[model samples]
Target: MLNKFLDEVCSHIRCKMAHNDIRAELTAHIEEMQSAGKPIDEAIAAMGDCAEIGAKLDKQHKPLIEWPLIGLTAVIVIIGGIMAFTNDYVMNHSGSDFMRFLLFAVLGITAAAFFMFFNYTKLRDFTWIIYGAVWVIFIGSLIMGTRGNVSYVFLNWIFIAIPLLVAFAGFMDKLRGKGMNGLIISTLLALVSLIPAVLTARRAVIFLLVPFFIMLLAAVYKRHFGVNIKSQKAFLYSGLALTGLLVILSVIRNPYRFARMTDFITNVPEGNAWLISALRDAISSANWIGGADIVYSYAPSVAVPNLMADFALANVIITFGWLAGIVLVAAIIALIVRMFMITRKVKHDFGYYISLAACVMLSMQFVISVLMNLGMFPFMGVSLPFVSHGGTGYAANMVLVGLILSVWRRNNIIGKVPRENKNIQPLVEYADGKNNI
Candidate 1:
């Protein structure tokens, strides 16, 4: 409900006092001119561009770096590296193994910094191209992966497609406004990646499906494009129930494919229980303080197939003790909560959706990975985001973090904002012989 003058003022100035004072000065001038039959737009336009005024205000209010959040991430990265170092397997088992980890970390940090400083909305122009390319590469990989294990290429596709899909969803204003579009979008987006997961590896579709639900809920709750599912109680509960049932059924039907999913409930061993059992024992061995070194771990090495990547948090407890694991978990949760806070301040719905999607994706990864590692969930091979050591998952996740940082940067600057702020009348009025309108 902002007037043109106020809206224009906000675009340039981040200082609240300057905004209010200048807006107050212009309000009566605008109203009086309108009362005299002068169009409001003309009156507003006569006040001159807010840029010079904003430039004056910019000296008073500059965007500061989010050092606390950055500090937390740096701490987490250092801890992850330290955890990897504690493993005799990573340090002494092979040459260049540790170097590969360092490379991914550096790449991740670089990508994150690039996105944080760049103009995020510029992607709006290229989103369609990015979206089309994602589907093309992914679908092509899915087809090729069917013949043999092309998972490396497929993983690359998944990494590229996910963030780009989030970007694309942010820009789909028309589609968003059309109501059943959430359901349509949910199914389509879920299926796009789900198909690849199912074709290549069954029962891992949770990664694909979780984001659909997350994006849908975020869009609805935030009222992006004003779309609604209607029947909140029925929709939310039913959607969750259906998802749970599907997960249960997916595990039950494919016992051979998964590692003893119903161990707690059914007490029956499945064909693929070996790796799962090893992972579970490794996680469960820790009490308040975890094992000091990987030599003492229940698992032979952190260099084991799933140990470093999939069961990383479990590996952390094994190497650093439960206290460090608790700290790691708390740090991760804090970062996710920070993302929610940032999402609230974003001025654009597109940016909002991107932030929400990033939060959703990261939260989903952590929850699924932790549960799987601890032997409480069925989805296997999920990585613990930045904490895990794989190049692909780690780098892709860092890019998502970059997306979150991009949104946070946008949130910091008050600007040509969304529709809700338009048409708003100024609250503070003042006499200004200053600008001589």
Candidate 2:
């Protein structure tokens, strides 16, 4: 009878993905009634109309489409396609580059769709596995030894860092209520994760490290790891001190990097600062509607060495005008804001952590990338999200988007019904043995 009732109820639910959880929740309620010595028929009848109950459950558990985000992503991809077209045809004169971008764009979109439907909460159970996988990949990258291009090593770590950090969030959650020991353990793990980036000796590590630290410090600030307020403050101070010390040590060790920094600050004409000057000059000379003549006169037709990736923003402003650049920036900003909004609506702690980390990472990448283009910050090889032309980066950004969408999709649903079933309520009432709506 209970199965029949469930079947009737489920028949009204359009979301088949939610059926198992709904079944489990309804089963728990029916079982509770049976344990209370209520007749099954009476309990089933008292639960109200199957169709109405299922309809309400369906409404509550319905997947959120996040169309605004989706639309924005599409618009940005179109913009990227235009940039690729321009870069290939007008600049590189290689007809093949645009097709490559198109292939990756399709793959990225497909990846996002897969992750959108994927159950991200399952990641919580495999936190350590993911953490270990990151370590293994990092080791493998080292063994492979750059293979003539250091980007091979960089790519391996870059793709893994986001997921590793997300897993760290889950790891931290598991340590809640363990007090100072938990804090120490989590901090150790966080530092351990930084080893690969540090060993790579790439400033891009800054992009990964900053966001992960934000996630860690945020957890500490909220007392999520069971540390008292004073201890949290001490942790914060200690972290800042450690960061400063590491930065100083890094500069002392990498004399060439230090020289580049000094040159940028001193405005040495032949140093890396020239890239910044060129970017500014191009922007300054740009007409608001068309390509800048100054850029074409001085630089390659693409306007920069890495016009498709690191300095894509400069190309946008130089080739398409500030008006087009502003629209692209606005779309990226909207996507970041949309990701931030998702953090608020996520009910599950795991989902919340993943979304929050992804948001912070995306926001930081966008800020740093823009700064790199504008010459406010050193070029750390940070690519603009979605707008940049690296296949790995494009795919990684899409995966993050998909994970966030997965979180939003299941915001009101749970994979497992709690044993107590406190949130489960009667769908109908019985008054004087009469069915009441």
Candidate 3:
């Protein structure tokens, strides 16, 4: 009967790492009871049934798949493909671009589902590997030359780097426990990402950089960086103030950038008014529903230069009119907001950061794209995540969506430790020496 109890447990338990420890713990519990004057049979009987307990633990360890959330996002992206279908370039170019959008959209959703349903926590192991791969891309891009056409790897590194930033939050959590070295260690870890951003030299890198800092600061503010929350926040506000000052400095230092900034603001240069004027004319022509002839005839240049990329939203508003644009923008804002709401369910610091990072990245790009179209900001060619027609952009965006979904599905759940089996017990019948029913 003594041997039978361990055998039943060993057979039911799946994670081999915990097997021996569980065995030792259970044996000690029985021996402790025996030493307290109970007989072996009575002591073992006190432990109860192993099978019932094992089943409960099994449920806790299993990965959950949130089908409704996954399906909603999948459908949203596909619905976004609607914008691509009606665009001037999409229709005239034999629909090849739209086809690419569909293919990559599917690929992205599939990749995300694969990651989502799997053990996402295992990704913490390769956080640095993701960081290293992005660094490799940055270095390779430099050697290959950033001019002319960009490579696939280089273009998608932003998406890859964002996930690494999310995972890095867990590393920060460890350092927070380390005292003074914790802040230094976490700062160095952040530099891994900044090196690549500086090398790329794309002002647009702000799309990725902002969230990394926001989330890193948020995590650190929550004590993931070993500093008091108030201290980290003071530093965060100081950094923001400094960033604004530098932007002002940058515009002052660079003649061309400043000229564009000034022209965008006041339209002082009649020459640059064409860009802003074109956007206004396009929007104005769409009298709630759209006067397609007016936009094509009066504001052709606005949609022509980057119709399907940076200006996809402009195309949607023009073609489909005000209601369509409002609905699409609302949907995107809702998606980001929903992501934040989901983060509340995530217990781990890294999971919270990943979900929030994706939301911030998507939100920043959307806001910037709209601002760029309206001539409020210089054109940075940032694509609207789901709406943009680029393959790499769409695929990367979908994957991030999946990552958010993965965080939600697996929130606070450990990969291998079954909740029910956490406390195994000796079968009461066997423990009582009544081996048979």
Error of 1 at 356 (Å): 1.1
Clashing pairs in 3: 56-420, 57-418, 57-419, 57-420, 57-421
Q: Give the alpha carbon lDDT tens digit for every residue of 41-118 in model 1.
A: 777677676777667766655654666667767777877777666554543544344566688899989988987777
lDDT of 2 at 91: 65
lDDT of 3 by residue, 1-437 (tens): 65577667656655443345455557767778878999988876777787865555445444556665565565457656776665436334334656767777778777776767655566667777766766675677667875432344545655656656655765764454464456556655765566655554455356656876777566665665554666666766776698789889988999887776667677553665566666666666775775455665544444445666777777777777777777776776666667777766776665677777777776787788877765677656687777775657677776676777787766534322222333545444234443231
Q: Write the residue-wise lDDT of candidate 2 on 122-236 in tens digits.
A: 7888998898887776687667666434446565454766778778878986876666787788778877777777766455566667766776676776666664757876976
- TM-scores of the models, in the order given: 0.74, 0.85, 0.78
RMSD of each: 6.8, 5.5, 6.5
Residue 134 lDDT (model 2): 76
Candidate 1: list runs displaced more than 4 Å: 1-64, 88-97, 139-146, 180-197, 201-204, 225-252, 255-259, 264-270, 283-299, 302-305, 412-437
Give the whole-model CA lDDT for all candidates, comma-separated: 0.64, 0.75, 0.64
